[model samples]
Structures are given as C-alpha cells and as structure tokens.
Target: MTTFDRREEGFENKFAHDEEMKFKAEARRNKLLGLWVAEKLGSSGEAASDYAKTVVATDVDGGEAGVIRKVIADLAAKDVAITEAQIRVRMDELMPQAIAQVNAGT
Candidate 1:
C-alpha cells in the first residue's frame, strides 16, 4: 500500500479504538451510577449487581438518557428524591473513574 493509504488505514484503526474505549467508559459509568442509585434504594449484594446490569443494558438503545430516565423513575418509585441535574453531575463525575477503570482493564 502507498504511504497515504497506510496513513488512512491507521486513522481508521485509531478511530475504531477510540470509539470502543468511549463505549466501554460509558458502560462502566452506567454501572457505577446504577450501584449508587441502588444503594440509595436500599439494595445490597446480588440485588445491587443485578440492578447495575439493567442500567448497562438500558444504555444499549437509550444511551445515557434512557439510563437517566430509568434511574429517576426507580428512585421516585422508592420515595427517593433526586433531580436530573444531580444525576447528570454524578454521571460526569463517574466518567473519569470509569475511563481509568477501562484503561486499567478492570
């Protein structure tokens, strides 16, 4: 392949890798968010883990918004009070930790 073609291929590969990392980070963030919400709802052990998994699954189609909606509805059902802004802020805060965890292969 020509140098230009090789460079293009490299760029494509980098883009794919970056996208994968972003997905992993977001999924991790969702899991963390779910666990936090679960704690607020008084879930522990296996129940908390299952709840976190559901949050991750929600992201498959709904992305962040769906997860937020699900958590908000759940918290409200349990009489826990939290605002959308607070959930968004927590998502932002968890992102870095999620990214670090993803990079570390944990």
Candidate 2:
C-alpha cells in the first residue's frame, strides 16, 4: 500500500477505537450513576449491582437521555428527590473517571 493508503487505514482504525472507548466510557458512567442512585434508594450489595446493570443496559439501548429518564422515574417512584440538573452534573463528573477506567482496561 502507498503511504497515503496506510495513513487512511490508520485513521479509520483510530476512529473505530475512539468510538468503542466512548461507548465503554458511557456505559461505565451509567453504572456508576446507577450505584449512586441505588444507595440513595437504600439498596445494597447484589441489588445495587443489578440496578447498575439495568442502567448500563438502558444507556446502551437509549443513550444518555434514556439513562436519565430511567433514573429519574425510579427515584421518583421511591420518593427519592433528585433533579435532572443534579443527575447531569453527576454524569459529567463521572465521565472522566469512566474514560480512565475504560482506558485502563484496554
């Protein structure tokens, strides 16, 4: 392959890797968010873990908005008071941690 061809291939590979990392990071963030919310709702141990998994699944299927809606609804049902702005702030805070976790795994 020519130099240009190799460069293009490298760019494509990098793009794919970045996208994968972003997805993993988002999933991790969701899981972290879930655990935090679960604690607020008084769930512990295995129950908390299962709740986190559900949040991750929701995020995978419906993106950030889905995660937010699910968390908001669940918390509201349990009489836990939290605002979307707070959730969003927490999400932002966890993003870097999630990306770091994903990078470490890779």
Instruction: Find the candidate with the highest lDDT and give its number.
Output: 1
Model 2, residue 52: C-alpha shift (Å): 0.3
All predictions: root-mean-square deviation over Cα? 0.4, 1.1
* Model 1 spans > 4 angstroms off: none
Write one digit per residue (lDDT tens) for candidate 2, span 1-106.
9999999999999999999888888989999999999999999999999999999999879888999999999999999999999999999999999898998994
Overlapping backbone residue pairs in candidate 2 total 0
Residue 28 deviation, candidate 1, in Å? 0.3
The candidate maximizing TM-score is 1
lDDT, candidate 1, equals 0.97
lDDT of each: 0.97, 0.94
Residue pairs in steric clash, candidate 2?
Answer: none
Q: Estimated TM-score per prediction?
A: 0.99, 0.96
